[model samples]
Target: MDEMPALDKMIIYLDQLAISQIFKIKTGTYPSEAPHHAFWTEVTNLLQQGVLLQQVLCPASDIHRDESMVFTRGDELTLTHEMLGGDTSFRSSSEIEGDQVWAYLRGFVSGKEPILDLSVDSILDGHRNEWLSRLHISAAMDWTGIAKDVRDRREMSADNMVPLYERWRADPKTSFKSVLKTELESFGSSRVTAYLHFAEMARRGLGSIPNQFVE
Candidate 1:
């Protein structure tokens, strides 16, 4: 965390693809004659100024860091991921989904509805303005290990999806409610596992768990 700004900043999450376009424009990797180049340049300039002025907070997550690894380190496309994010880091989607599932379960157990908030503020590391530091990588990573892990995960996913599709085909659901129970159970377990992976990352300082948040 860094010193807090006097005002709360609005959160702006840039999509990975748009970030890549901006990088291409800035690095001249995209043709100057391309009509779309000017649009990205303006966007890049606006966001840079907004972040620099503390008028907006752009928090990146482990998802961004991991996805950027598709490009080699120091690649123009790689640095694009960092330009506006600075030191701000957000919770992984896995953690948020887990929290959602936990909330829904608690609501069912207590016989009272749980109103879960899965908004940006719920996952932010600190005050909106506190992470306004120089450009920083949101997660500290072991690139080689991550690369291998990704390959293995994809291969395993391909194999597992076969049974998943087989189960769906056998079920023959005619309505959303027909499969709601199975969907909830399946996703709840998946979310828990994903959250645990994030929990491991948090231990290494790549992410944060709020003092009051529970898995």
Candidate 2:
């Protein structure tokens, strides 16, 4: 059961890169006197205190945990997420989109405006608000081999996007709308196809219980 966090509470969103920096500091790869190390360490400590005091909400999402696939065994980011992410998470974009789309479809049938809850509270899932529930699984097994793939894809995209970007910028007539209609359609289709393929892989990886997660 999720508690609607105090409306007055500030939101702090830490993406994976920030988490990785903190992880490095934790492992002492960053020297103690390093400015980044000290900065991230202080930031993390303050965020932790803020959460404990309910002065802030550092919400996370499924992608954060999933992206941790890039980290191998003995290199768990789960604990860092537990400490800062605080169990409050946004439902995945797909799930939220599915619900909104379904509601929109229902509006056509009922001939009424779609009644959708767009508030942050509506999307949050506080899996365990109690103090004890934040304890993360310590041991990690089986690196998912995504780090290399991510690096390769990044490098590939960097190489590919430059010319497209230069071409677009050079053409005064080029517009986002035109790009969306012409180029983005294929990418969007591929995105959905890739999501389905990955979902299937996830199902197979989980074996018997697709919804259940074991850290």
What TM-score fits each model?
0.63, 0.58
lDDT of each: 0.71, 0.70
lDDT of 2 by residue, 76-174 (tens): 576766566565667787788778867876997999999998766677776334343445444555556656776676688799888778878899798
In model 1, what are the clashing residue pairs, if there are any?
Answer: none
Number of backbone-clashing residue pairs for each candidate, in the order shown: 0, 0
Q: Candidate 1 regions off by >4 Å?
A: 1-5, 74-79, 134-142, 151-215
Which clashing pairs does model 2 show?
Answer: none
Task: Provide the lowest-lDDT 10-residue window in model 2.
Answer: 127-136
TM-score of model 1 relative to the true fold? 0.63
